[model samples]
Target: MTAASPPSASRPRYAVYVVLVLMVAYMLSFMDRVLISLMIDPIRTELGLGDTQVGLLVGFGFVLLYSIMGIPFGAIADSGNRRNLMVGGVLGWSAATAVSGFAGGFISLLAARAMVGIGEATLSPAAYSTIADRFEKRKLGFAVSLYNMGVSLGGGVAMLFGGVLVAWAMATAVPLPWGELTGWRLAFVAVGLLGVPLAAVMLLTVREAPRRQGGIKPPPLSALWALAMRHKAAFAAVVIGYSILVIAAYGAMLWAPVHFARAHGMSPAHLGLAFGVIIGLFGTVGLAIGGLLSDRSAKRGHPDAPVRIVLASAVLQFPLMMGAYLASDTTVALVLAAAGMATVSTIGGLQAGTLQILTPASMRGRMTAIYLLVANMAGMGLGPLVTGFVSEHLFDGPTSLGKALALVTAVSLTIGVALLLLARKAIIAAVLDNDRAEAEAG
Candidate 1:
């Protein structure tokens, strides 16, 4: 079934409030997801883990559960109350992160991380669906871009907070009821506790926008499958193209700090601060800029603005990333890395907003779920694991991390550009068809 426009004229002033809540929720999940990166050394020392094990803990373990659960949670979001799903998700991930602080060995820690992924899996599909319901299609690019800033914000804050949190935990030697909770353990416990209040805020302050389906019952799974089959070309392009971009993103995100430390001798705290500011400042700016450019371009008759922007970003990202990895001077490397990150960060918001624009309202949640299931599973599952494997096997030692990163990013970005270009004509056709259908319905 085709989508009809929501009565956007009656959208409440409180819609912005909903975006704020989701943004904070997005930030909370990311903090939990990335805090593990900062704790790698302590986790390795205490758990007697190797690079592969640590990669599994950070990459595949969490994402495997997240990808599997996204389909069900997405279906739930399509048919049920999204706000409640988000509340439950926030609480579940928060609790799991705190539980991770108490894990005794690799097995237990892996289990806890898996739970965290399950909880986080509930967020994006629901949040994106809600934003689509509340905002008009014309403004979706900017709105989704604003919402996606949480990703970079959460990641940056995690790195910065991890540095401070680690330093404080090490200095004070905080005693806990369970045991001597210091270093990485304290970081997990401290960050995990932050979500409790945020969850409460989400429950008390946010209201689910009425579903766009109105009195129409959500279509059956078979019908939904038919709809997906109808739009297979567009879906293939978006899901595969975006997932490929994420490979480069996750690879860089998971390993950039280690690269800087090994190659340039920057300390963790300094590296964290530098990257935190770069990702938080430049990444946010890039998302906003991309969204605005795409939105304005659409207004000027470019129906495929989102995909075009992604293609441009992919083009810019490869060269900058290669430069960052290959550069000898620390200052030059950082400048190039920051530019590369700004481009990389644009993909999340643009792809999400674009998908929302292309899919029907009834299927937005499930379609988003399918996209996440494929994108996260492929990107999060392989990006870090591949980089780590290269570092451990192909390279003589850890110091060759820059070379490994360069090779992975160069390949992924190139593939991503190809897929997006292939998807472009399909995306343009979908946008035009939706416009014609909406006009006819009106």
Candidate 2:
């Protein structure tokens, strides 16, 4: 087999532009995805719903469709115009978000949330494939990490801004121009509206990189299926492990403000700002550090870097999460929570980069879709819901909410660690094989 040609030695300045655009798009994606958490109380009260319903709206309602649609969207991304897909996705989610402001009941809100998911489903696989196409393998980790910064920044922005927005809306006590829209509705509208201009910018500014040169064009569908079968173990582990981790992460994020408010008697605005700062700063730092470290380790021939990092993160996370759960002092709990966020976020870049390395360029989108389907279904879909269920049923009151969330997080991390450890050997072998193949092909 002919070797794949080495990518350009000097990275282009345009790459920075691409990264910026992708990051913004990611930010918007997450903001739309997560802002609902901050608005949960207001929406729940307005809709006369319980925590279980709120959990379903935030978790299963959004993630089920998002996860399910990601695959076909990913497949389409591989062969279609990535720029168009991304722009269209942005528009769809943005519109959905705006409509969420107008939601009169639970069903309308659920529909809006599902629409947001459908739009978001198009982003990751396409974005990952585009990034891989643009950057060399060596730089891919950092580039991907930069894009993943959206996860951290978006969460932070959602929490921080959601709080401020909700607080402002509550204070204003003004009638909506359209009708009797509340603060939560206005927040959704404002956040959703921001996506329109960004979509236009992405359309104008981001160009899809040329596909890798010189490889025989394998049929896309067959290629994806073959790749999945070939790396079944790694793919399965990544999907499951990632899903579990996300469940814990999103669960913590969705309910932490409410937990803090009830347990510690803090205001929503204060809780939002605090959580946002922690997630934004520490989470971003952790992701960057992890990606850089993983890339360095991989270059030095440590094929297990991804798994090792994830394993270490999972192990460290359990105690920190437990501390956050059990600590009586708000300050101490916040500190521990920050540490936990940092540790867990390290997996983002490592997982994305690993998948890129293991799969062919053509199948990157579909593989990512598959990974996301499981990850979101389990992680995003169940994380918040499980925590809510346990808090409501098993724990039986606000006092036990922290313990319930903490226990669920711990259990998920424990399971994740075991799976990651078992997958370590397979990840190493896959990395070695990929490197060997790339070297021979080049």
- Which 10 residues in a row give candidate 2 its minimum summed lDDT? 1-10
Global lDDT of each candidate: 0.83, 0.79
Q: Taking the tens digit of each residue's C-alpha lDDT, what string does model 1 give over 1-442?
A: 2335554436556887788789988988888666677668778998999777887988888999998899899898888999999999999999999899889999999999999999999999999999988877778888899889898898888777667877887676667686687778877888889989999999898887776656656667787677556767877878888898898988767778778878898876887798888777878888888889888888888988888888888888898989998798999999999998899888777988887877777778888888888888778888888888887788865468888889889888888888778778887888777667546644
Residues 268-342 of candidate 2 have per-residue lDDT tens digits of 788778878877888889889888887787678776766677677778878887888778899999999899888
True lDDT of residue 107, candidate 2: 95
Pairs that collide in candidate 1 are none
State the RMSD for candidate 1. 2.1
lDDT of 2 at 312: 76
lDDT of 1 at 151: 83
User: TM-score, each model?
Assistant: 0.96, 0.95
